[model samples]
Target chain A: MDLTLKIWRQASSKVKGQFVNYQVQNISAEASFLEMLDILNESLVAKGEEPVAFDHDCREGICGACSLYINGRPHGPDRGITTCQMHMRNFKHGETIIIEPWRAKPFPVIKDLMVDRSSFDEIIQAGGFVSVRTGGIPDANSIPIPRRNAELAMDAAACIGCGACVAACKNASAMLFVSAKVSQFALLPQGRIEAQERVQRMVAKMDELGFGNCTNTYACEAECPKEISVSNIARMNREFLSAKLISHKEF
Target chain B: MGKSLTYSSITKKIIMSLAGLFLISFLLVHLGINLLILFDNTYESFNTAAHFMATNPLIQTFQWVLFIGFIIHIIYGIIVQLQNWSARPVRYMKKGYSELSFFSKFMIHTGVVVFIFLIIHFANFFIVAKFGHVDEVTYKSGTYENLGAVVVETFKIGWYVAFYVVALLLLGFHLEHGIQSAFQSLGINHWRYTPVIKRIGTLLSILITLGFIAIPLVIYFS
Candidate 1:
């Protein structure tokens, strides 16, 4: 299928960017979205033009490396899947696709489609962990966790640090991301020891990082490739409130 | 965080919700009082109720607090919207974020309209009742500055009544999103309670709006 692409291009972070148009002919419908981009890049390289740079690793959606805002969606039109998982079959032949980078203030553009998502790493590093030094990876059976608790922990743990939540959000809020980490820790016995400190530090770091506040638009939950619940946000709010009320410690 | 509510986004949200909930609760009380007009022979009851509210000590204290609540809610709303606006200085080229309702996008627009409506409303009723000239009318019982008559006189203008009804509908729209959202923002949300809360919120918003609108309709038609 032939397709027209209007892709945002910039030389670097300091330079201005514009939507540059390109056409790729006779692309296979079975090709993944990234693969389509790969095909486009191959042609661009062959023609002695600069290849359109984008971020993709593993290409299987787990890595969360492929971040592209396709046709105004974080991961294209397909729900519950990353850009790499989306197929060209979802698009009609001769359709024009406009691709842009994730446009959050924190997640600055590194290149064409690659954004500096190190802000997420900083936020996670702020408080998203159990600080205790467990000597070994010992018996999981020793800790009697209820099935419901285990399930909820795993659900919160599903966040891949993809900035799509921020991208999809009108305010570019990272509440979903922060809440996922908060809920993951708060729900577990091992991580609950420092719950007060964890919730406080992470929220402070999130605020300091210039990420927008959640207004409960639920767009993040809708556009989430992992289908992370916004309920995690509510859970985080509870944790934050409880922590602030109970502890005299300041961050 | 410099011990300021504005410094923390969560606290700002919590404050917004608390003020919203206060305003929401007040709407119901106001609705109940306004609903008195629907009765054929309760004009004195309506004025007496209004007089009681105006003259009572506790209700008088609450009236000041209610004004403060409205002030805070509006101010915080502007602050949040401005912050949200600056956070995304670059707008999206394509329009595809229809995932959320128009309510989310146009909160400010609806809010500004409600504010305008509020100014006109307060000017028409609140100022007149408090400091403006009001005629003392005797309706077979006693002569008091008939607050009910003042209300009825205002509703007599056809377009004014129309504007009042339309503004109440907008208030309903605002409350529809505000009620459940305020609960969620204050960390009162749960998977079990959220759906139920949203339903109650919607129903309450519609009921209060209709209640207020019903008064204008009855007064205008009569």
Candidate 2:
């Protein structure tokens, strides 16, 4: 397949970026989107030109490293898969593929198609964990968690920390991501101990980082590669409200 | 602990949801009261209801509450919308092709239309009944401002009725998304009940729109 790629190009975070078109010919339809980019980069490097830069790790898709907005979707035209998992066959023979980075205030573009997502780290650091005293791995049966709760927790835990929710959201809201992180614990017994504090701190951090508010658009759910449900957001809202109202926690 | 709840994004949505829900309730009552006009050509039942609403202290107090709800809903909607606009400083050259819910995306636009309609609606009825001189009608119970007559007369105009119909339909669209979205924001989402809530929201929006539209069409025709 021959494809025309309109990839965003930028030198640094402080510089302006614009779409630069390049044509890649004789490409296999089975090539993953990232591999296609690699082919383009190899030719660029051969010509002594700078290759388009993007973020990727664990090309198998669980690492949440590859963030590419292809053809107006967070992970190209494919559904429920990362950019690395999206194969070239999803496109036509001579399709004009537009690729860009996640555009959000928190995720600033570092270079072509690569945006810094340390803001996610800061949000997680705010309180995305339980501060359990280290001990021998406890027997799984000790908690006596219901099967429904565990399944729900695992579902929320499926988030790979990708910024597709924010990128797909019209408001660039991180509600879906933060809510998934919050629900991963709020649904379980062990994580319930610090649930109040976790929701408040993480929400405050998300708000402080200049992420937009969720307006229930559900675009995040639609674009999520992990197929994370928006129900977690409602759960987070419930948790946050209870934390602020019932719990006697200070700022 | 020191953070204000008002500043939190979730809390802001909670506020919007609470206010929106209150307004939605008000619409049901408003529709009921307006439906009285269609009962008879004499318009006595509607006039009495309007007079009671205008004079009853509790209803008057609730009116203020309703007004405040509208004010908060509008103000917070604009604030959150502006913040959302600024969140993504850069625009993608290609528009998204995701199958997002169409009504949810244009809420602010539909809301603005409803707000503009409210101003025109207020000028036609509220201001006239409250401050401006409106003709009075006498009933067996008492005499009061004949607001029903104003409604009937207003709807008699072809263009005004057209505008009213259009505005109500837009309001319906707003309510369709707003109702379910409000429930979701209030943390009422559940697998067992969310689908039901969404259906109820759509049904209620349609009923309200059609109910309100009936008045103008009936008044104009009769």
Candidate 3:
């Protein structure tokens, strides 16, 4: 199979860039999307040209590193799948694929398709952890959490910090991302200790990091590979308001 | 004060929602008066009401309050938008797409157009009635006249009617998203009733906006 590629190429964050086109010939339809790109890079290397640079670790899609916006949809046209999981069969022969990096203000480009998602990491570091110290692994049933609540916590914990929610948001808000983390912790027993402070600190950090406010658009949920619900956002809002009400001075 | 400032974004949205609901009430009242214009014999009665709205001290005070409300709402919206823009300073390179509902994405754009429309609407009707020339047509009772003729004449013009219809359409679109989201932002989502509440919100927004829009269209075509 043959494919026409229009990939964004930028030398450095300081320089302006544009789409550079390439043709990849003799590709297998069964190849994963990233594998097709790997073939393209191999060809480029053979011709003594600079290879296309993109982020990927576990090409199996769990690492949240293989971020790519294919055509206009995030992680390609499929729902609840990452770029690495996206298959080349999703494209047709002689198709012109327009690929670019995520276009949010917070996620800056590092090289050809890599972005600095450390802002997300910074937000996580702000308060995304439980304060409970590691002693002996506490008895599994030591803390009583309702089964439903535990399930919800696990669901919220499913967020992989992919920054896809940010790219999906029109306002570029990180509310969904922050809310998921907050909700996950707020739902569990160990997390209840610092729940109030955690939400306050995380929300503050989210705002401080320049993430946009949630407009309740639910677009983040729609484009999320994890299929995280917007209801988590609602829960976060309730928790934030409740926390703020309790300690007017703390937050 | 610090707490208020910290929660100012949500607070401002609350204020916007309150002011919007107030404006929606005013639309109902305006619609009632305009409906009177549909009856040629009752046109004078509608004019009499308009005169009261224009000149009565109580109504004048209310008008001032409404003006303040509008200013606050608009300024707050601008502030929220600016803060949002500053938060995300970098653009994404991956060109990811969102599955955002149509009304959500277009709120700001629709809001801007509606704001412009309000300016023109006030200039035409409110300002004109207060400060511009009023050629009153004598009532059937043969006593006197008011500004009903001016309103009818203005609506008769193709451009005025067109502009008004377009503006009202924008308002309808704005309300469709604004009403339900307002409730959600205020934490009104309950398991059994939230969907129903959202539906009601959608209906009210559509009905009120269409009601306002229908008035001018009816007068123009009739």
| TM-score leader | 2
What docking grade does candidate 2 earn? high
* Docking quality tier of model 1: medium
| Each model's DockQ score | 0.62, 0.81, 0.47
After superposing candidate 3 on the true structure, give the runs of residues whose Cα lies further than 4 Å from its correct spot: A133-137, B1-15, B48-62, B83-96, B131-147
The TM-score measured for candidate 3 stands at 0.89
Instruction: List iRMS for all predictions.
Output: 1.5, 0.9, 2.8
lDDT of 3 by residue, A195-243 (tens): 8888888888777767777777887888888888887877777777778
Locate the minimum summed-lDDT window of 10 residues in model 3 chain B.
Answer: B1-10
lDDT of 3 by residue, B1-222 (tens): 355445534455666767766776777787788777767554788787777787789988998888877786677677677776676565544444665667877777788988998898889888888787776766665432466777778889898889888888888877778777776666566778778877887788778777777767888888
- Clashes in model 2: which pairs? A250-B1, A251-B1, A251-B2
Native-vs-model 2 lDDT? 0.91
lDDT of each: 0.85, 0.91, 0.79
Q: Name model 1 segments beyond 4 Å from true.
A: B1-5, B139-142
Highest lDDT: give the candidate number: 2
Q: B-chain TM-score, every candidate? A: 0.92, 0.95, 0.86
**TM-score versus the correct structure, for each prediction:** 0.96, 0.97, 0.89
Q: Order the candidates by DockQ, highest first.
A: 2, 1, 3
Alpha-carbon runs more than 4 Å astray in model 2? B1-6
Candidate 2 lDDT tens digits, A1-251? 99899999999999887889999999998999999999999999999999999999999989999998888899988889999999999999888989989989999999888999999999999999989788899985987989999999999999999899999998899999999999999999889999999999999999999899988889899999999999999999999999989898744
